[model samples]
Target: MLLVSLILLGAIGTRLAVLQLWQGHIYRDKAENNRIRIVPKPPVRGNIFDRKGRVLASTRLTHAAYLWPIVVKQPDWPKNLKYLSQLLSIPEESIQSRIEQAGYNSPTLIRIARSLNPAQITALEEFKTELNGLEVDIETVRDYPNKAMGAHVLGYTGELNAEELKKRQAEGYRLGDIVGKMGVEKAYEQQLRGEWGGIQLEVDGAGKVMKVLGQKVGQPGKDVTLTLDLDAQRAAEAALGDRKGAIVAINPQTGGVLAMVSNPSFDPNVFSSQITPKIWKQVQSKGNPFVNRALRGFPPASTFKLVTATAGMESGKYPPNTILNTFAYLNVGGTAFGEWNRAGFGPMGYVRALAWSSNTFHGQIGRGVGGPTLIKWARLYGFGKATGIELDEEAPGLIADDAWKRKNYNWEWTDGDTVNMSIGQGFTQASPLQVAVMFAVPANGGYRVKPHFFDNNQDTNKWRTSLHLKPTTIKTLREGLRAVVAEGTGKALNVPNLPPVGGKSGTAEAPPGESHTWFGGFAPFDNPTIVVVAFGEHTGGGGGSTAGPMVKQVMEAYFKNNKR
Candidate 1:
């Protein structure tokens, strides 16, 4: 009997030793995890300023209510959600949607409500004991002071998506972090996002804080100053009105973007807060309110004539005084190319032809220089490539060559295509930003200035290329452009009150009843400072009637405020 009792006692001792010595750490770690919580403190995002020190974007501190899913059971969610819905004055379905969007079933804390008013906050605090696993968290909300005024340029921030988080996790971005989704905000995200810090807290089994263990404050992001003129931006947007169009203004002296406007702008503030599915669909529709039209491609219309004129003169096919016979229509192959005015400008020199914007005259020039020469001149003037602007949304406009045509369309280039391109009506396309650069080249000493938004001590003089263009040719083009505003298609823009402005007008055919209008030029013809380009989509009217006055209004306001 004594031997049997000793055997049972030894067996019991062995079992206790196995659990205490071998598996002790595993259980201890589980208990520690239950009692300790690491709460992350999101750092404040940086502020954005315009060149004149106007605040464009900044951060505002606000309170948000979060739910600890581990502490709140699945069965109790309905009751808890109902209580939260009443306290926050939000629908219970909305709270559930928020929880689902946040993946509340996962280990991560879910933010169920944000932007709490004082009344909501007081109620949440007073009813804290009644709410299960509910905690208030301080959140940094992105704020755009000017609202939708510069939405494209300022951009907006939103919570990171799964794809973004996967890509940025190595860069220290958390799942719930708000990130720049577009515009300068996205481009300078690294500079604008702050480092996240955290605090270790001792918590009870119910997830209530018992003691503070340790904490580290987060670092704020650095500020970014842009070379945008607020007043000029407002003026440009006002001139554009509610039409589907864009306006780009550049400092002729430095290629610095003064003002850029894309109409039908959505409020960045809408993106800063939680975006509703309906609002998201509305902004992401065919209208594409998020796209920066200044950097988007469009049929350039007659503005591309500037490229044709440059090519013609440089190829030695058409001199400054070279006279070309122009009629109502010119037949090339099976296609009949016609001028805007059926009566035509008759036979005229290059200067007069440019002023009249005679399609027959440019078609003849296109035939003389052919497609190759036009493409070369177009590249020289910064086409078929991004202008190397600070923004990433810029489109490298199509300047299709023979090789490109064969590869993309499986067709060879033809004289008909050349003629149509010369008039800026065929496959040729460009952005308003490119148009501004094309005209600014002549306005600013015939050099291609790299368009920029930030202040760089870049030697613009060194970046200037004559594009193998002769001084005489530039002078002729400049004089002809002046004549355009004085007596030709752009004559409607000859405002008596404002200083003399020289520009080229263009009307490119769109669909059956639509035309894209374009006007590009510099002001005060004698001493130009600002280069402006205005483009209207499906305007029906030509450049002189549609985009011309918009440019005039912007230029007039700029000159009035600047006063060189």
Candidate 2:
């Protein structure tokens, strides 16, 4: 029994010695790993520049204050909250609420204050030693030098909150990051957001960063240059002059968007970094500054007459010289449709009626062209389809047809519908961008060019297409459009010493006693350089009085500046 006891005692001693001496380092390393450490790194957002290399959107370093919840140890929570609130210039209740929400056990960093100025930084520094949980770090925030000018196009960013973080995690985004919320920023987010960089640091038991172990430097995102002319954009905005409307201008030859203006724009800087709930609520409640009206759909008004003319000409239903008698009013299905002026060209040809914008003439042509032909020509002109521009939330303008009417309204086609469609009214709707494309088609000699804002290093030649039209048809339409500007209703927009210009005007009635006025035209009629479309909401009268003058001024500025 003594020998067996001795052998067991020796084995137990050997096992204890092995555990203490041989595996001590391994267990110590495991214990150290259990104290979790996470270092968040942010990716550099892309830069936005104009076609001439002017900076439109960028990022700058700013100071952000954070609180480490686990390190905070206070006997009186209220006292600690008061101290933080006074230092951060935040409400005491808000500070206390955030602390309670962060919980006590976790070591996650919660943002208490952000974008601190120099004086605020000094104030925060004074409390560093006394505030156990407080931490100040440097981070980059979006900066727009030209405030509120291109708000609808450039968009803005905001810090990721808890719900946003969950979405980011699912989409492979790291925590505590800013993302594009609208405009080009949101549409090309993947290309604009580069890879993130990370750093490893050794921390002491006190939770202080003791030493930097390793780091991978972040790469700056690619610079994107847009086709927008800042000066022209500003001019367009100025011309809008306190009206609710939108304008889209494009280079007819290349399909490059020159200027896009939507009035009542909000400053993008408001959304950069962290947008407080109060500010966000205010923005949402007041007049919808977030809406991009250029992409929003509206009745094309008389501007749609261009499409009717194209359809009629293309379908062999009517020539430019085809004659129709225009009475002051015409009756279709007991509904009297009349001209805006309440006077008609007693007996006129197609060209004369188009230049005069005779409602009765086009209405008669629409009947001759029929519904299918109208829809075909409208689709061919790029209506009823998204322009495929690199912007968020584009609306495809509606083009009602027999099938569409049957499916949506559960009704058959009527002569009244055809007449209304011919006049660019009824259920047909389009965006300013779509109208710009339609104007560009005739200006470019019948080519259907896809509108684009970014070049992105692609060869310009690759994006060009030629839409062949009969030379006779092109000539007839060109003369008719010029006559409209020369001696007809569009005479108000005629400018002296500039190249010959051609255009069409339209007035579309909105619901509940509102009106949408529109004008679409191209400049230097011989070799068109630019195509412009302008619209004004609730503006009384035709496009000539409301939208034409605006288009004229913009064209004048563009021609004088470009001087080609």
Compare the candidates by TM-score and give the number of the best one: 1
**Model 2: per-residue Cα lDDT over 1-564, one tens digit each:** 999999999999888888778988876654453243444456778898877778889988898887766556667566768876766667887666666665654455666677887877887778777765677778777889988888888888776566776667867775456788888787777777777776666666566687776787876677788988877777788777778888888988788888888876788887664456677777776477777788888888777777777777777878666777888888888888897669877888756776888898888778788888888888888889898888857899898888899999899989899889889899998999999988887788888777888866576555566556667677777887888899887887787856788998888889786688988889899899899889887776778878988888788888877887
| lDDT of each residue in 1-564, candidate 1, tens digit only | 999999999999888888788888876766676677667778899898888789999988888887766556688888888888777766899778757765554444667677787888788877667655677878889999888898888777888866777798899887578888888888889999989888888898667789999999999999988878888898999999988989999987788889999977888888665555677887777477878889988878888888888888888888787888888899999788987888677789777887888899989999889988888888889988999987898998888889988999999999988888888877877999999999987786577877788755577664455565689888988888999999988876688867887899989899976888898879778788889899998877888888888988888788777776
lDDT of each: 0.83, 0.79
List of clashing residue pairs for candidate 2: none
Which ranges in model 1 have alpha carbons more than 4 Å from their true place? 1-20, 73-113, 117-132, 204-208, 281-286, 461-466
Instruction: Assess every candidate by TM-score.
Output: 0.90, 0.88
Error of 2 at 424 (Å): 0.9
